[model samples]
Target: MSNRRDVWITGIGLVSSLGEGPEAHMQALSSGTAPVVDATGFAPYVVHPLAPISFDAQIPKKGDQRQMEPWQRIGTYAAGLALDSAGIKGNKDILGTTDMVVAAGGGERDQSVDGAILTEIESQPNPEIFLNEQLQSNLRPTLFLAQLSNLLAGNISIVHGVTGSSRTFMGEESSGTDAVRIGWSRIAAGTSEIALVGGAYNAERRDMLLLFALKRLAMHAPWAPVLAQPRGVPTGSAGAFLVLESPEHATARGAKPIAKLSGVWSERAQRNEPGAVEAVIEALINQARGDVTEGTAILSAASGAPEPTAAEVAVLARSGLPVRSITDRVGHGLEAQMPVALAIAALAVSQGSLFAPLEGEPLEKPFTETLSRAIVTGVGHWRGEGVALVERAD
Candidate 1:
């Protein structure tokens, strides 16, 4: 097998509070404008930066939007933008012939139903029976059809007719990058020339919020954390997708290659394990290139979680690359982690500026004298760890 086949990201679609497209989002990030705001919709959790897409406010088609899950709606919205960016029409014939892969960090359907249940209980008096009955009837299908991580993939497949090959991964946060690695490997193995890869997630449910709080993945509120204690995953919903094609395929189609998805490195550092995270980053640098350690930017997976973020900071102090977490703008979601990383990396290549993490204060002391390299880490509950080290082409 060829060690590497030219895999280039020719097109990108993004849904974040900053903006809908890559350029717009990058501009917002570079300008130091925060898109975070109060959370709305059915999600009751305290959210600092609610990155809802512009489409969320618009009215959906009769019956169409009514039945669709929140994640599906986000995915559909991202899919449209991604395909349009590539100038590829979402036709059955076009999709049917191309090999495709869909993956997510989290499922959105269950959360939407959870939101519905909470809404019902709030609106009704003595809502236990009423909520149960509604859940039994209306929420069951969402549980059956929408809960699985692959539902959105099925929905996309039906919409576009992408029949060549398919697979889905829910590595929590790392799932999106894992899907990209798998797709890249497939293309390298001569399995498929083209692949549509990205991730979508919605944390818009009351139960999901409470669960995250229990797990210490997010905070209930700024005051709750500042006064009481820190807990839970930061609430967020996002959809980001990319069109990856081999050089020959893109060249034949007259598509401009945005940047080569040259290399990907993933590591899993359990709270109980030692050296797991460092080993992964070291391996990534070695595998990427013999000289990759010199002045490369790292698209980091530094979600707002304190422990993992600290772990990453320690690793960076040792590794020699400047670090940044892009999750500060869109807020962080597990499933969307890697896809979001990929999207920001794509923007870095296009905009000619390396993006930095928005959450933490810049290091008081320098990790190294030379700040040429940036590390983008994908941190979340699932162990789909990813680190991208990139250098400018001469």
Candidate 2:
């Protein structure tokens, strides 16, 4: 913590099933309507699909769109949105020095190619040889190129012109948590001035559903609020990115901060012992010096999986704060979950009001007064735990 500079959230870009931008999400939340969920398409699994968005608005060039995978496109577009929100989209001077940190996962799998391989391997006597040979002969270099986790940052640099230091973090929810954490840490420590940070997850794919289902983590037909019961995760398609800048830097540019990113802390606890996740959450909250006072809400990225979700809710019980399970509306976005929560928290703090109570979750109380502070927590389905605090800039 070098001199401890204030980290301001100057820009936020969030696209989820609820809709796009701050206004769309605020409207959906104020209405307290049941979120959009797709049950029949994935059959047994319920997923919050990405809302209809025109890629041309952000990714502009056809050449850029064609060269990327769905997740990469999603990330790139979100990154552009963040840059635009920061009021520095075309400023080559600032962009040349702006650092970026992205939380991302491996690219989406090509189901057709995967299907072909599986089908053909089923009949081959030497399946290993056939599989290896087929992979070597049929897999295009372009496939691997799309799978690069850093492509989100690369594409952002290409399309948005954020030509600065870049980093990509993997490992699902924790990765999202740490992306902002590192961004804040660097800016606060004076190691960097302005930075672009966040992630995107296109969970509307069969591969993503299959991966979650394998762990018995898919929510079926009767979709309910995340904390309504001990439920499985309903995957969501979303992309979220935020622009963080130091107080001095933002003020110099005449950029008004929406909220101040006060603190960020994350951890991974061993799940072999019961109550371990709860302990991790407590420690992380303590680290952030998170306030759980009245007029504050907990924007929990509870992923909706039983093990960690239960433990996390148990810990949050001590806070006695109004809680909102964001995934209930936006669904579970692995890499983008925590950052999106932070963005929503910033919006709530700035607007001075909490959203309507989450339906089906009786304990998720609604605060009628203006919102002042938000404590955002991320509990990974199986592993990491993180906590962050955002408050009104004023």
Candidate 3:
């Protein structure tokens, strides 16, 4: 482990309900203002809406923007921001070989078409035949193609000129953790010099809200801090990406690292089994704790789901470190949660400070000392669990 190559976070592209870019997020975090939440837009179900953005800034081509669904557009836009942040946006030499890994969910559904089919199917004499005909006639070929998870990576390659090997994962929150894990591991093992990694989520979609509501996982009350909320998630729209490079690669390119990604560990626990979630989280935290130093804090991506959040809270409480929950500020981003947590951790480490507590929650105390490192943890609402260590670069 001592001889392994060091991985550095050289660039970050983050967009959320707070805003776009590192500066915007830093400002929001420093202000200690209430997170922007929309409790009325979706009615009882609260959500953190995406801040207003002009897609033209990152994606210049109208044709390209027209073809992508909302999630793809968000991811591609963030990918462009990452390349630009690394000072390699138009530099074909670097981008031509930059490995790409993306975490994504299925594409958006055409609600109007779906509604119409459901309404007409009830009247048809032979409902099965009618449904089949409607499916073949109403759905566009492009829509199905757009639904493929890899299109986010494809769009990034087309618009940003990132032509290296591409890999896409698709298991909700777990996918995001694994994507970052793979990117950091590749650089650490000398399998790749630099990589672009992240994911995006669009919570404004009715289809997604319906899906979560079916499982009783969507919040349907007034907005509150994540820990204060009951057994459900206040989903948000966000796109987060990071550019990771081997220390030698970053130094050779004159790229300054924002933070050092020392270690990343991921696991899955049988939530049905009592204490399984807590056990896995505790083990992961202990593994990363070896790198903890003075002024270290935790940035937790604890989805507001009751079971996993309780498990995470318990483990974090025992760690005896000042902790802050990312979901409180950005809302639960599902597949984008881990990358967003990692991005914020890097931002905090680079600035040598932690953000103010959310609503002065007892668990999140004020940290007045200079922050030297951060342990970012993600406990998926249902399945995955992960921990990562990020330290200030020397």
Candidate 4:
């Protein structure tokens, strides 16, 4: 829309249970080995089928860890990987020459912890005396400060010394894509030369999964029994970042461009709007000149279940591009949704291939036929707010 300036992905950083590096992640996705495991890091939190992640013990000890929530760590760590991948080492001189942005969402605390706290309060002696008026109320301010969403952006900037234009969002699954939009805008507008854009989420809590199951939004695909739920958000943890810059800027600096940020389009779905989903699909195709008529493939956002997957299928059926689902293997990491999704999109663009979800044998259904140049769709339940998104192949 803004003269269509050329933008390229020069770097990518990912920290997921599947494996930290790009090649390793790609291998895991291809092999169908889901990094998701039952919650063990915080076993005291629950007993159920959870997507667990083995934390890197090598992470340095800092006072921030004492106060920062797990998601902040994920954000900082993920940002570091993207900077390392981009070859940007926090130099003021370098950042001064580029603009940057951080995209994220799910600032809401998973209410599942409230039940556990209430249980703990029950065991207190003279529970009424200690908990009646409100110990939690007194501690609310401290807890609120610890989980502020902007803290993630602040942590990332501190890690990488990115003193440039910054942007943050809270659109859950669409957060990363929206962040990319900001980065693309900065470079195209000549405000900055390069930008770091992505998302992160720390959802290892069992209550997070239980909450989604309550909403019937949890993974309920007939085949993904382990991840199935009747409602609420699926629990997941992931951090990823992408280095974006104008094609001319990257080439001038001799950066190996991974993929071009070609086109992006989104449409918000209304409550029970019959054609709301298709409306977003049409918007994407129209933006891409009626399906990038010459585009190669599509990267789908469906998270390996029937309802969301079926919704994506119908959208792609209209777009006329092959649709592929990455979540079947990546697991559902919410806010980290597009950061991981777009990062994989960059990889496939460079390799000239589209990746597919791993075979579940009993439950996995292949979307390979439709995922060649696919449309990635994500359905989120942060209270009736859902989104549809599409990204083009390089």
Candidate 5:
């Protein structure tokens, strides 16, 4: 551990319902502006819709933009922002070898095709055979390609010219945590000099809404702070990417270290057993909290699902660090949650201050001290628990 190289977060690209890029999010956080939520668009169910983004700013090729779904475009654009922030946007020398890890969900479904298949299958003599035939004939070939979880990475390669060893993870929240963990681990171990890591989510899709709704996991009431929500997750459309580099690599390139990624710890708990989530999260937090003195607060990515959120809340309360749930403003981004939380934590640490608390949450008290470190915690709605420590790059 003593020989491990320091991992620095040199650049960050974050887009959410709050806005695009770090500046917008910083402003939103500092000002304590109300979160933008659409209760009626998805009707009864509340969601944080993504603000308007001009895809041309990052993905210049109209053809490329047209071919990608919203999630891919979001990720590709965020990746470009990160490279640009790192001053390596068009620098093929660094990008060509920069490793890439993406956390993504399955591609968007073709609703029209799905509807037609369902409609015709009921009338067929053999519904099973008809369903199979419709699946093959009705779905477009490109649609299948779009559904590949790795397409987000592929699009980034095409548009941003990353051309690195690409890897994609598909589990929901765990995927995001693992992606960051691997990127940081590689940089720290000197296995890789630089890495691009993150994910994107499209919360406006009906299929995603239906998927959560069926499980009674979609919030159907007015928006509230994540911890205060009675039940369900208020999904958000977001894209977050971070440019992680070794201290030597960053200094050699003259890239300023926004913050230091000290450590990342990930775990999956057996939720069927009582107290398992709390136990796992407590252990991960203890591991991540290395030599910290003071000015440390917690940025929690607590998805508003009742049970896990409650467990996380209880554990955080015991830790006694001032806690702010990022989901209160950005909504629960599933795979993007961990990255978004890390990005915001880095931003806070670099600026030497923590953001204001939500109006309604008593647990998220005010913190006026100079912030030198931040702990980002993620307890997935269903499975997966993780904690990451970010410290000022002094």
Candidate 6:
């Protein structure tokens, strides 16, 4: 343990339907505010869409904004905010050395091209030949590769100057979980001094809605809280990025850390069994290597999806700690869900206060004691589960 480096959360950049920055989120959470859900736009499928933001503020270059997809722009913009929050924005010296691990889904699909192919394919005499022909003629060069998830990291590097080694993970909620896990591992192991880790999601797209709808996962909303929902609920549009650094590195730069990231654990649970996820979560919490006490709290990335959320709720029930599920406020962010939860958890611990529960679930108790520790958790709709623990800054 003596050889382990201390990992500190020095900066956080978060943007969602709730608002921008940690302060905005803090104010909203503290006030037990109503979430912004767009029921009419996507209809049947509800979305906690992003509020308006001046892209010019962060991604000032119009060309950069034009080339990147909405998710990429949101990510790049958030990366800038993280750098700024850490007092390293525009500092070429520090930015040049900062590594980044991003969790991202593939780029936006070409709906027009897709629709055209779909409409014309059935009319073709030879479906196979026509399909090939359409792919060759309709799809632009580099379109396939451009949609690769890594491009988000590339754009962040190009626009933000975070040019050190980069990696991108792509498996929904687990992707966000591992991005932070790897970033923390590197810094903790002394392989890297400082790193940026997080993800972004633009859930306002039709493609995503259709993707979820195929599995009957899309929520048609009059919009109620996650616990109140009969099943899973709305997805959200969000971007979350964090600047994590070794304690010595942060201290040398005179950057005051907001929180300490003590540990992270991730796992895949077989959904076929009744309580498999609950068992997995129990093990993950046990792996966190600390005691659950009076000052501890849980920030749940509870996907309002019934099967998993219900299991998660059961586990939280026995813990006796205050639980605040962000789903009701920010909605389920899919890939960005866990990252958003972690960012908010860091903010809550840093401020030493618990946010009022948005949904007011029966089991979610109010804590009067200042929060010193937190359990940030994620239960993926289909497969993964992860938990990370953080402590208030000393």
Compute the lDDT of residue 286 as modeled in candidate 4: 51
TM-score of 4: 0.78
TM-score of 2: 0.95
- Choose the strongest candidate by lDDT: 5
* Residue-wise C-alpha lDDT for candidate 6, range 1-394, written one tens digit per residue: 5688889999999999988888888888898778888999988878999988888899989999999889888888888888889998988888889999999987787778888889988899999999788768886555545356888899888888898889899888999999999999999999999999999999889988998888888888778677655375589989999999998899898999989998888899989988999999977876663656868888888888888888888888777778888777898887788889999999999888888765447766778899999898889988899999999778
Residues 74-176, candidate 5: write the lDDT tens digits: 8899889988888899999999999999999987878888887778878899988886676688765655353578899999998999988888998899999
* Order of candidate numbers by TM-score, starting with the best: 3, 5, 2, 6, 1, 4
Clashes of 2: 3
Q: Give lDDT tens digits, candidate 2, residues 122-221.
A: 9999999997787688755555443589888899999999998998999889999999999999999999999999999998899888988898999988
Q: What is the lDDT of residue 356 in candidate 5?
A: 93
Candidate number of the best TM-score: 3
Error of 2 at 349 (Å): 0.6
Which stretches of candidate 1 lie above 4 Å from their native place?
Answer: 39-63, 91-93, 105-147, 223-232, 293-295, 356-360, 364-375, 389-394
Q: Model 3: per-residue lDDT, tens digit, 293-386?
A: 5799999988888888888888988999999989889998898999999999999999999999977466898899999889999999889999
List candidate 4 segments past 4 Å from native. 32-61, 96-98, 106-117, 120-129, 132-138, 142-147, 220-234, 289-295, 303-309, 360-375, 379-394
Cα displacement (angstroms), candidate 6, residue 59, comes to 0.9
Residue 283 CA error for candidate 6 (Å)?
Answer: 2.0
Model 1 / residue 2 / CA error / Å: 4.7
Model 6 alpha-carbon drift over 4 Å, by segment: 122-130, 140-147
Please tell me which model should have the higher lDDT, number 2 or number 6: 2
Candidate that beats the other on TM-score, 1 or 2, i.e. the better one: 2
Model 6, global lDDT: 0.86
Candidate 4 C-alpha lDDT tens digits along 293-327: 44445555454334444454566566555545555
**TM-score of model 1 relative to the true fold?**
0.80
What lDDT score goes with residue 164 in model 3?
A: 89
Count: clashes, candidate 5: 0
